[model samples]
Target: MRMGKGKTKLMAAGMSLTVFAGLLAGCSGSNKEESSSSPKTSAASPSASGSSAASEQPSKIDTSKKVDLQFYMLGDAPKDLPLIQEEINKMALEDLNATVTFNFTTWTDWSQKYKLLLSSGQPIDLIFTADWTDYQSYAKKGAFLPLDELLPQAAPKLYEFVPKDMWDAVKIDQKIYTVPATWKEYVTEGIAYREDLRKKYNLPKPESIETLEQYLDGIRKNEPDLLPLADNQGYHTESIRQLTTKTVNSSNKVPYGLNIMYDAPRDVTSYWGSPQHLADLKMYKRWADKGYWPKNVLNIKDSGHDVFASGKAAALLGSENPNRFNDSVIKIKSLHPDWELGYFPYPNAKGFAQPVHPIHNGFAIPRSSKNPERALAFYEKLVTDKRYNWLTQYGIEGKNFEVEDGKYYKMIGDAQSNGFPREGMQGWAWRNPEFMLFEKSFDAVLQMFSDFDKIAKPDIFQGFPEDWTPYQAEKAAVEQVEKQYLYPLNVGLIDDVEGGLKLFMEKAKQAGLDKIQEEYKKQWIKYLDDSGIQ
Candidate 1:
């Protein structure tokens, strides 16, 4: 299996240095010996993985045994705390009786970082992978180690804890290669419209994309100050999820976005291979031309929640979760008392699709990891322990949060406790959500959460092993084409819609549209062959 040993060494050395520098981050320092409880965060921000994740150090480590694990992650780096993390590290080492440490790296340019890490074949102990984030691509190139070999002892608890079907789904070439995180329910993207606007215009809540177009037309006819619809330019996935799915599966329990993870129409599905792929794109384009959606949505960065929240636009796209449904939409009720949030779950004339998978961006050991046992032991401890999970998920309970009738809530004022930024980090997204312990009371605030332990509908995509998609060149080419023409073409910013479509199709054709379609067909057929049910 070895090839060009000297070349491998040189490449590995280069990768290590590059990874450490690029991913290395400073730590938070504290003078006091903190208590057992975790710290708090100062303000609102997006969640990340490193600091908020679990860390454990045991009391008695066999220092005579030392091993290093290289860790890969997405987003920001952890802020070290000499007093905090050192104590955690010490405890984990003591428990396992082995010294385990990390060589940390993060991604700014994902494609470039992936290229470097996978090709150099670094001795990575753990890496974050996803179907959307080159998980399959890296596996194809031998960047990851098949976990089946290590799970027995190196990760026995994990071997026993993780679900079989879920793990099996991540297998590539007949071996389990990745550990997927389970996603929570109530994560679907739906169209949210202002009820007050509906009533004001004497319009009905949109039930289908056809109805939605009528509603947007109404907005253009009456609501001069507001956009008929609002959407994000760079985010085409949400549009696909909302406008296209639900016609197939109407269960109301599924939680997928559009383009990459929809599960509906019973007989047909796949992020990009769905039957309505062309229809969804064409629908958005039609809305764009009529000024029914945003003028330059395709160019917008984040979804324009702020505009919709402030009542500058009619609707915004998001999930049924608390933040999107209750938090964002309900907050508007206070501002416009008559305002109500309505769902566009089945815009394509059907109903609920399947839920998104438990998940797939998580840590797995590379063969290069000399200390995989220590690393996995550390991973197991972090997921199962109460102290570790609590700190990682909730910050400081009393400070970052406080309990009311045994329900967890983020704390507001009376600030005395050190904020989490001073202790660990924020966002532990890539960790195992199954092992994550949350006070059940939090579910009461959820908008449409089903009994997650018994998800109403199974994912059609769940455990489906997809072939490596070499769509990087296509993605690059599409982004380029969109950059020059998306907003203009969509908004009739161009002279003719038909002409624009022709031009766009011609460009996409050159970018290998047919080839991409053929590639997906090969994989889909292979998937049918392997599953043995078809």
Candidate 2:
């Protein structure tokens, strides 16, 4: 699976989302107090007796009266989403007697728009949330309802659907506020190269960073118009940062500007100031000068895929989400059938810092939801029921997709042409064990995973969620300072790598990078003791 700016949690290794003030239900002014306390009719409603018995009773589920739930999700609203929603609603009416209204935060300014939508206190029953989408931050601020009691009661099926350990992973301060989607996910940072281009020009398949470099060098020598690689802004610089530092010990914990190194697993420090950062910057400068990437890469909004599809780029550098191979690569092949695509995983030798988890994308009930119980009920069926799953993920089976006896599911007609948008089904945020229908092209994707397994390193700190409350302010300030210089340095737009890095370090220190590091280290020590990670 590929992780991009929109899909992945933007890491601080030069790629981070702008921090925005989240809209907590209590802070909506009109519903300020109501936001903090559970609503009267809600599954988790507060009672004077201090008993959650009300929300924990499955008998309370009201299926007679029809209720319409508003679901907000990140990404564009697909053209055929309405058609899919209509079909899903019909099934819901027969089962839960509920309907759903889908709302979207477009890609243009999704991070900002997400904040505004949540902060607006719109009566959203369910919203797509993830570790990358500020789920931890929002939970700390009480933007979502605690689902521990209500889940077991109203959505017993769903409560049983997710494994207990998976449930434990989403807990913040011992309270569950989000439902982590259960996906059989395998993702890693890799390069997607044009296989045809390499063979046509007598180049070897890109198997390592060195091989990749040679391929790019060949392209630079032969293909004058097509860029060896294309980028947009920072372009998952963290992946390259990881590649350059495969030798350096870094933490498995999600990057937040600073963390423990592999060698000193207990110590916390700013990676921006590390030797790896400088090495990457210098190497990128050389690549940029040699015209590996477009000269105006920073200004180019198009993704490497788009650039490749348009015949302007040769390869893409990113975290490939295994699920997206068909949608991304197969679709591209349709346009340029002559071209063959191949993927080269990062740290290609052996092991990854951490495995990609499904919690990166999931669903959460907002505190503002009037029907949290019903929403979970609706969500339960979407994950467990085959009919609902197919509808949610692939739209009307015959219309959006078709399956052959021995072949994997394939998108057909308009759905194949125009992708079923992320918002269309919130498919990524749902449990997809039984729901995940394979694609014909999935063999290649699976092979890449099998190859990755040979060298995949397990991160001991994988499920430990860092509570950012103590260092939120310091981290935000340092992030802003890092943002200003990181982009330019990452893209090789800076004149001097050393000079720019020195200045970046200075500003980061002034912006409280040290304080953030200390807090992170303090928490990490406690986490180590708690998790028994000696």
lDDT of 1 by residue, 213-292 (tens): 67778888887777766655434334444455443222222121122223312233333323354455566667666776
lDDT of 2 by residue, 146-183 (tens): 99998877787677656665676667778888887654
Q: How displaced is residue 505 in candidate 1, in Å?
A: 2.0
- Candidate 2 local lDDT, residue 400: 64
User: Cα miss at 18, model 2 (Å)?
Assistant: 35
Minimal lDDT window, size 10, model 1: 26-35
lDDT, model 2: 0.63
TM-score of each: 0.65, 0.81
TM-score of model 1 vs. true structure: 0.65
What's the true lDDT of residue 87 in model 1?
Answer: 49
